[model samples]
Target: MSTSAPPDAPPALRARHLRKQFPGVVANEDVSLTLRAGTVHAIVGENGAGKSTLMKLLYGMHRPDSGEIHLDGEPVRFTSPREAIAAGLGMVHQHFMLADNLSVLENVVLGAEPGRAGVLDLPAATRRVEELCANLGVRVHPHAETGGLSVADRQRVEIVKALYRGARILILDEPTAVLVPQEVERLFVSLDRLRTRGLSILFISHKLDEVLAVADDVTVIRRGVTVADSLQANEVSSRELAHLMIGAELVRTERPAHPADQTARRVALGLEEVSLRLSDGRQALDAVCLDVGEGEVVGIAGVEGNGQTELIECAAGLRRPDHGTLTLFGRNITGTTLRRRRADGVALVPEDRHRQALLLEAPVWENRMLGRQSAPPNSRRGWLTRRAARRDTEHLMRDYDVRARDADVAAASLSGGNQQKLVIGRELAAEPKVLLAAHPTRGVDIAAQQQIWRRIEEAAAAGAGVLLVSADLDELLSRSDRLLVMLRGRIVAQVDPRRTSTEELGVAMSGAGESAR
Candidate 1:
């Protein structure tokens, strides 16, 4: 069903026949979308479905190969992001771009400062920023460093930055991917406020429920084509949206094992009374202890900033615990170097793939050869073998179904799902005895998510222990043999995955459930 706008209503933005193509891929093909003032428009699609490509076109990060863009009923073309911003279009990227060492006010006005002379007009900028924050109900510390803020707070700063630039149309890409349930609620509230103030919002997300809850209209894209447009949120169900995006029904598989007592076995990874303090002397991890056995997937579920990151870093030997013992295969490894841990068969797929997993500026083949360049065949006598690395990367790309043009292309050129596939492919090739996967499928499409699940299960079936940390409860419950809830820097409860409900898990993760003895 489509609702016609009022006679006086004008479209905030519209695109016609937008087309973009690379050598081997048609990134966006004759796609079109319309957005009206004060409405939340959502674009849903599988990864590589041209959602990001379409947004880049709209935001002027890339000029459309062939198309027309209209702003306020007039034909307009933008050559760059700055041009788009000047035309009242602003975008908040999935990965934030803020200076970690700078204050929030400074980061917000980094490019557009209010000053007549060389010196910055700090007072004017701060006042305007404070007013913007108040108007949007976005709470951000003006004097606080961007590095010291929480994920949610940092996102708010991004929103405020867009508003500060006089953006009438706002594009948010996967805004809720890193947020917990509570943070998501707050974000939705802010979006609603923006809508009320006659700001047009273009929301791109993989989470169907969030789209349904917040969007006024939904548009579905598949394989670079617009499959459905002007879809009313109330008229469609989540199941139908999933089918439209994935082109098939998603059959959620059950965890392989039933409840059983295998607690007596030698643990593959064990943490005993681990504690960690930050550089500023704040306690990040407090006496945390957990264990994962072979042939098992132990899930760590928590809201962000609940010490999950510190826990993962300590497990991977990237950070040392201030106190306590870390054992891998019954060997003390608390003070071991990261290289030593990796050599001891410890593999980590970090939460931030762009930062920790792959080198963005490097070629796919070079990335595939990382961490194993010292081994035989690929390298000898401190020399690199490009041919061998390329062949291996090509083979792994095919085996993992990474949809990329060539192995020589930069890793950053691939889509989010394909990048994740490359990371997983490279990490799994190590055949580690223990795998630490944090939000492995965070921004991937449904098909890629299924492939990742299969890979994780394959690892577990091969007697490799898995520690899975994610905010996605359905994914956690479906893949993990057992679930451990982390709250306030410690494990609060352990439950059989098959026996827990979403509500119960939420409560446990929030520290409202009975402690596990």
Candidate 2:
């Protein structure tokens, strides 16, 4: 399945014998690859399989212990990211870094200003940004504040920033991990356009369906080495890729068949006329209404930034709705503090794990005690109990399969999957009557995702009402008894997962289908 170019034309980029080692592990070893010109190349691997390390080495974020990189058939050494950019290499990292208060135009041209004099040139930069946006078919406001833009728009701005620097080869890391099906389609279209214009792309993603749909060729990595370097994208399937990543077939848990009666079950959560206006003066939520019954899973599926985050925050008591009444188990909890809501048997697995869920600087045991300081095991009579906390942390580590050296280690030392495991484990340990889960399995490996889903399913089976918010449509369909679609801050449709398809969900998510109630 190898498709290397003929001997006459050189590759757009090439790397040989890359080796990088950390204190306790060999992150990468003897990895070599090639990116043919005017083609989309993909690197696929599970989390902690050295995908990010390899990309960092290529982008000059870290120098390899041993390796060589060549651009246009000539050897080149990039000492810094700036050097890589000057050599026509640009990378959009998985985590976005944008100044919230700054205008989109300012953030785009922050480091790469155009004018020669010391005085800044706003008009020139705006025009250049507008032109780039048009060429890429990305719709974004140049004058709007960065904080007001959606996650998809911010990602487009990041790409426009890279293109403004004259990048001929672009690297995108886990680009579609946060996007819904519709937004993923738009991104694929943009990538295809870039390839048509003769630009080389190196895409990094674990989503195999996207890899097959968007890439011309694929490379699979496992255990810090390239397992298959020349697999043609069209010849591979997601099942095959999963097997390659884990060296075994993926196992799926069987969901229980007992359908809970929506009317007979006790109501665990009730929201009525929930509307929210964001700080930027935009309508984030539009009179949304939903109800979750005990022992039921109600899933909210939509494109990112379609008020999913806002909805979760309002439910978690982090944000106050401009208009709505929130009740838990027939008790009105509107305008209540998060702690009071938590004490009332409410728990949240937030969307942004790093920013919202756990404290990175704390030990694993302390993180396990987070959000539950008012309860027992971690605390007794308003006093923190170290021994009990440590004991429970060890139990969670073993049960949740958090791969850490010890519970005494910092939470920051763990991988993304492990961090997510800790968060889910801690949240579920609270034994809340209602769970608000937002992208709980995002950025995790396939195995980790399975485990998380199993935990959520168990919680729901035990009569815990779950509000599952996810960009993954398959996850929603598999776990949700009922599915609700959100578009432009409004709940546009509701359907049973057993009778719906991803195609129908995609249309409803994009607001192009008939509204179902």
Candidate 3:
């Protein structure tokens, strides 16, 4: 099945000599690429390397200061995203843009909704969505509430949303960041199906293996400049691509040596027979007992929505379980408030940074004081001080290598990777007894991921227990001393990270080897 376009065919999308500048920074300069029809063209770069800015310019979210954009070989200019969509371009942002309260059908037909003489045509939209999902082999019920869907299903809904709008080209940003190994395979299959139908995809990802796996073309950007363009993906190795992206030898994050054995170490976090029932009458968590000893890293692997979120929330004191005993250092803290947990040396890096960890409109300094407003440095003698907050913000930025003009700038202005770094630094700076991190390095590039891993391991080596939940099997295999598999609200397996293979772990996650413990 040859998906490549003929040599004589015009590119589905092309941008040449693209240049964009913002105050105090040049976001993208000299960026250019041609996305051939029926092929996946990948764009790779380090954080702040201008890939996002370039995509923005292409999607018409931000108009280029100077450049030429051609859609189907005709020069055009798009003033906004609406214009780009009208011109057959669609973009799926890293953070999904969907109303959780709505059904999948409602979310998909929201913008270009069908109408029969001023009346919403719900049936027509549902049929169309159903057809699109079937064609793409995406199994999502159109009428299902979006809030309850798995992460993979939500992503499928977003993709189908574009197709419903008649998009010929799609720009996917980190599409596989939160996907398991199996889910990643399914997504690639869907992308292949898209390619067969002559749709073009501009893939942006930090995972080099994914880019090499599915992309037909590769483009590299460094410091807002296009370092390389139109490199054939099949001819390039992951090592070669890594070098091109960062212009340095790629040193993959090396996991710190795992502490020898955990029998003697005291428990930092302990959960005994925990169970939770959601308001929807769904059993979100079965009686799950767990323990993380001081200086140990415990990794949880499961498909999204298989109770990982609930587990983390319960551990963080955001959710009160129906029946459970949560102990910190052998002391019951099951009913403790989130603030109490923090003060008791439990630090949490929540999964959703935007909703849980940060105020987008606030400056970096204010965000640094978010969870610890009453703690020392942030406050003294029960009074918060802006001066100390600002000082700490400066320190975190410097230490974490958060790229920003200054701490006074709004957090919304930093790149996603930088925002993630900021949040991790804010949490880790407390040096808590336990670190609860969920997908902490979701959207970051290679170098930033290394730094984050190093920090988390340093905390563990300092005798702080860490409970890590991630979709990245490699991270779990490398960083964790023990890995737990979750399925249908219960832990079904616990395997030694050093002994089990990722494929076996993926099977355990799916309930095949449910009792692999």
lDDT of 1 by residue, 124-214 (tens): 9999999989977887879999998988899999999998898999999999988877778889999988888888999999889899999
Which residue pairs overlap in candidate 2's backbone? none
Candidate 1: where is the Cα deviation over 4 Å?
Answer: 1-8, 115-124, 380-383, 499-504, 507-517
Better of 2 and 3 by lDDT: 3
Task: Please give the lDDT score at residue 106 for candidate 2.
Answer: 91
lDDT of 2 by residue, 81-152 (tens): 999999999888878878889988998999998887766687999899999898788989998999878788
Best candidate per TM-score, number? 3
Q: lDDT tens digits, residues 200-303, model 3?
A: 99999999999999999999998888888989999999899888877899787656665466578999999999999999998999999999999988999998
Find the 10 residues in a row with the least total lDDT in model 1.
1-10
Stretches of candidate 2 off by over 4 Å are 1-7, 121-124, 253-261, 374-376, 380-388, 513-517
> What clash pairs does model 3 have?
none
lDDT of 3 at 493: 90
Ranking the candidates on lDDT from highest down gives: 3, 1, 2
Worst 10 residues of 2 by lDDT: 254-263
* Candidate with better lDDT, 1 vs 2: 1
Ranking by TM-score: 3, 1, 2
